[model samples]
Target: MIACGEKRLSQKRKRPNILFAIADDQSFPYSSAYGTSGINTPAFDKVANAGVLFNQAFVAAPQCSPSRAAILTGRNIWELEEAGTHGSYFPKKFTVFTDLLEDVGFEIGYTGKPWGPGDYSKAGWTRNPVGPEFNRKKLTEVPADGIHKTDYFGNFVEFYNQKGNDDPFFFWFGCHEPHRVYEDGSGLKSGKLLTEVDVPDFLPDNKLIQSDIADYAVEIEWFDQHLGKMISFLEEQGELENTIIVVTADNGMPFPAAKANLMEYGTHVPLAICWPAKFKGKRITDDLVSLIDLAPTFLEIAEVENVPQMTGESLKDILFSDSQSKINAVREFVLTGRERHTHARPDNLGYPSRAIRTSDYLYVKNFKPERWPAGDPVPESAKQIIPAEGFKELWPGYQDIDPSPSKMHLLHEKDSLSRYFKLAFDKRPMEQLYDIKKDPACINNIANDSTYATIKKELRDLLESELKKQGDPRVLGFGEIFDSYPRTSKMREFKGFNKRGKYNPKFTQKDQQIIE
Candidate 1:
């Protein structure tokens, strides 16, 4: 009787390890698993094949810092005051899943980029919110110019070595690839044919754009390469099946109109979660999901009691269920918004906007519709010159959009490609709606069309109602509070900025301290 009781106790389920791999600035449908041409992502495809491939996964915000913050806190960007904007301070008051896991006997560490371009120390945290660093590994040389030399797999090995034999672990592998400022011809240099790349409708379909896209593919491949190596290492260690592998991107591609804007290419990102020991494999789910759900999902798996007040719901049911269809029916839509991205607008303002995306439609509400959706025009208010040397002048406005070869092409050939340029950098209406089933590119705005008036109003009402429920200051008539949040990034000199009468002296001053 005693032997039988001991055997029963020993058979209790062991907690699983977690491997969360996130790519920086990658779009949905860009991975080879999604049948996107030119880019090859075997590691991402492997994970998807092993578990479930989420067909509709979106981030809470399109920008990097806020999007990452949302993922870390299991809350919407608007709910996270300072952390909601790019390069703002992270308040330590909000609980993170990593910290919770660490307290519960899990060894947590992260390699490469974590929640950043922002300061967590200002919030009084001892280390990065993700975990302690495992970024000491460095590569002697990189395949391309723009790629980071941080050996992500080597660092993971370092983190793994430090863990106790019986300890369950959580690792964050953040890849800072597929972002911007790529080597001009690295794609061709990598033997990728230009014909393999397909330019999106929003951009001009020419050699320049196709080559740019191909270059972007190269970086994505680099990110996938490291992920493959990590997976192989785990398999060799006989720990592959017991680990929950979560692969996704922080936001979207760093193209002219994709990264910062609340379009399909902006918030929509690739997601694949795998856990062979528990969840069934080869299931592709088409349900709409958000990255904000990640924190709650992690906490649920860890079995941590006293979960905080998080806005996002857990995906445990969807993961455990074998159904390919919607397991959680309440997740009918996901909300995305932006407060500030870069110091682009006058007075260091941001283009405040909120949007809600469903499976069939995307509705946007631009609170400050008159403001430029991209950024202010080039040639600073103080001076104006075409920059005799070239089109690649430093700080050549539209600062919201990252500086890229595609952006320079649009600016230079604005006359010939006026439609594309305007689409990339233009003021939008107060309300915009797109039938995503028909126009996935979001080129046609049917919000004003009488035929779809009823659907438009329904979406608009739903969006505002949800935002209000989340206590979003934008919808609460306290929208200006976001602008007052101190921006920790480099301030750009734009029209009406730093002017005596126009702007506040405190905001204009350089190196403003965190407002506790």
Candidate 2:
């Protein structure tokens, strides 16, 4: 849904101030513009109206660190070396988008989360992980309210107001919301009614799910409120129609079949771009766009001639066509994968999986499908966040093990579901393919069914071909290659907080390995 002549427009005018916004745990379900899910997102809706709404947008990785890293560096996880997954050990080789833009005379800075593990002082960073090695403004400044952090937008307003808006600016504001550690009914408390909510089939249809969804919506709306304020600030500064605004998230919600999985719920996210005075408004297109493609699009827009060694194609064709009838899609296909989720198990227990999603179906190849699809099945005491520091105690727990009969009885009633829960939580299979039309919730597995043999074969070939393009060491026959990748952080292991007292899982890698 890109506007026509984006490149031509870029070649003619001064570079627009880029305002890139990212939200945490946001999916397509939350945006009213998408209409697939029920949620009121006016701020997002406004942007979609003013610019292009990509109906099908995918993230490079599902988890926070890797996905955000991919977006910032314009490279895939494997290409980023040690910083390939969540809590990963990053090395000095990779450079982020902000760094490159700043080098080309743009004033760049990002607020909120950037997702690189150790900012330069830590093991893996060579340059300042986010931007230039040091802040040119003030390094040792503190706010009067005991909050020493400099806000992203407030700083931008200050910088441009003093400079008379002559210099181009690049600002990244990442939001930390809708990711849980949630207080149930907080949405209700904030005047949001659970009765008005619509529960997706993937979640159990009950008061619990409704309330949870409302709480999530509340957080997302709050994030939107912040984004709205940023937009307002731009208008007051007389830079409203000049800034190229991109609104999206890091990944999907933290839940079963999502967050860490290769499912659509894991990799699919909401993407909207708004640039007034640049394009037509109130248009939505079904072009499949990868978040990875934005890097190249940004490079092309800024007239930054060189392209990094990235796997994505620039979205030049998706935008304005000299021919009115030739409407090419933003992307032909999208790719996503994951290496590891948590440290609950050792041998660096990884649910190494890859996926290929077209407009219709999603195909996945699980290399270490022998590992738990959800998490390791251990004692009730094993499912708690023990040594949580600051705000990192928000990871999803072993939810399948909840002893309450409301869910427990329901779990027992469905034989395959019960086993699948154990399997989803414990380990997985080598191959998986889902017919999105019949099973949007993805509760059924038709990978080995004789009736779906053709579907399976087609998916297998697609998976192998894409993996080959990326030079995946697995299909080349080194299935255990991922195990050699270092587990940089043990954030999920020693820390857990559940119904029981302070629980610390002191298990070894060998103890948690799934039996093949």
Candidate 3:
């Protein structure tokens, strides 16, 4: 807790461990490191204070499945075929870095979520997606209460203390927090008094929104605190010095704009790395980094050679050296995309959007621009019933929702608020470009503007070149690429997170409807 003093020299360095801590629904807004929000995250603060915090860190996709898929594999989401979007379907052919690392003598293990929305066992995989289970305590600890799962952190320590000492670890500490359906007002419990939670100016500044943000901050803190404890554990175990500690979110915060969209709030994540043995490069780097590069980063650091085909560059050079004068940044831009989320909306729709995010702007070319961006509108049958409100089914648990009064108010107004919140969740913009510096919210698109024509064209070109390099199906035609790829049973099944069937996945079962 004392002001970070200079780290004096240590004795012989051991091959460092890699501690990858990923949080769910986390946005770049809160981390004190970003200096944007007023939310206090001392744990993340400590990491940023000690290490290099990437201001423009992004995942390959907005939603969890593809994002995680990209991280596990060193390729872009599209290159992985059916794993193109969340829980869509991932072909079993792709090779994951976890399996690769394990093959190379590193002990890999994880708890909590792994490559999701698909059948893990059927994927031709031997162990759990993360390899060797880490959540044993949860089998008995998590109550019969179907609403919750076991605490991932508690189970991790129990597993690691027993299994990790033998070899260097590539442990993935995944936290499913701040994601959804938390106990309201949970953030208020941990001495985090949110008299004022810094919220984005785009959202309505009512207590409802602020309280929503406060609850989110609390969950983020919960994840951060657990990670802080884990860090303490590492320090106790003498692994802190060499371990590459990366604290980040899978994608962005799960608000209207963040989770599913390719906007800054969605793809722009908070990444801070603290590797005591790496380097003392104290300043923040604006060089763009994608989660896809994670495999190469790990491979480079561990000195593994001739890995699978990779589009990602290693951060080894960036992390270990002081080449501030070099022109070789990670990449000029990072590409992001999505295959599906909710089911197709009214026109029986589905969305397939592709975008390229740069340091200055975000250019997205919506392939299915004609379809609703937010799946189809709520089912026509549900249209008669008024929309339900009160945080829309998925409210945070940290808030002090005096349900008696609050529920009454929410019940009567749920319909209106539901419809209100539904706006952002509804549609599409064809060719969109936002100057992140000026409009961080991505509310405005200057794609058609004459003055910004050159910037747009440049960005557009960058996107096309990158997509072509990555071999996106969209270039050959969305339907053609998708049809050519042939989705597996899992990716074909659409029953999105929204189970109402409003946007039921337009899934064509493997044998039932062959694309050829």
Best by TM-score: 1
Which residue pairs of candidate 1 clash?
Answer: none
Model 3, span 273-370: residue lDDT tens: 87876666455777788888888888877767678788877877667655443325546788888766533333223467788887788898887676
The parts of candidate 2 lying over 4 Å away from their true place are: 1-13, 36-38, 117-128, 132-164, 321-330, 379-426, 479-481, 491-516
By lDDT, rank the candidates, best first: 1, 3, 2
lDDT of 2: 0.64
Error of 3 at 99 (Å): 1.5
Q: Note the Cα lDDT for every prediction shown.
A: 0.87, 0.64, 0.65
Q: Model 2, range 1-516, lDDT digits (tens) per residue?
A: 546766544433487788888888887667777774436788788888787777778898888778887887777665554456665555555666676676666777666666644323344454546553212233254211122233445554555555423567777776656666455566677677767776656656667667767767777776676678788888887887988889998888765556777777788899888778675666666777778777877777777856567776666565432222224654556788887666544334566788888776787887766656665544345335432343233224443222222233334444645643442354557877778778755667778789888877877787788778777756766535444444445344323322111112332233222211
Ranking by TM-score: 1, 3, 2
Clashes of each: 0, 15, 22
* Residue ranges of candidate 3 with Cα displaced over 4 Å: 1-14, 36-38, 138-149, 164-166, 188-195, 323-330, 344-349, 386-423, 478-516
Candidate 1 lDDT tens digits, 210-300: 9999999999999999999999999999999899999999988999889999988899999999998888988989889999998999899
TM-score of each: 0.94, 0.80, 0.82
* Leading candidate by lDDT: 1
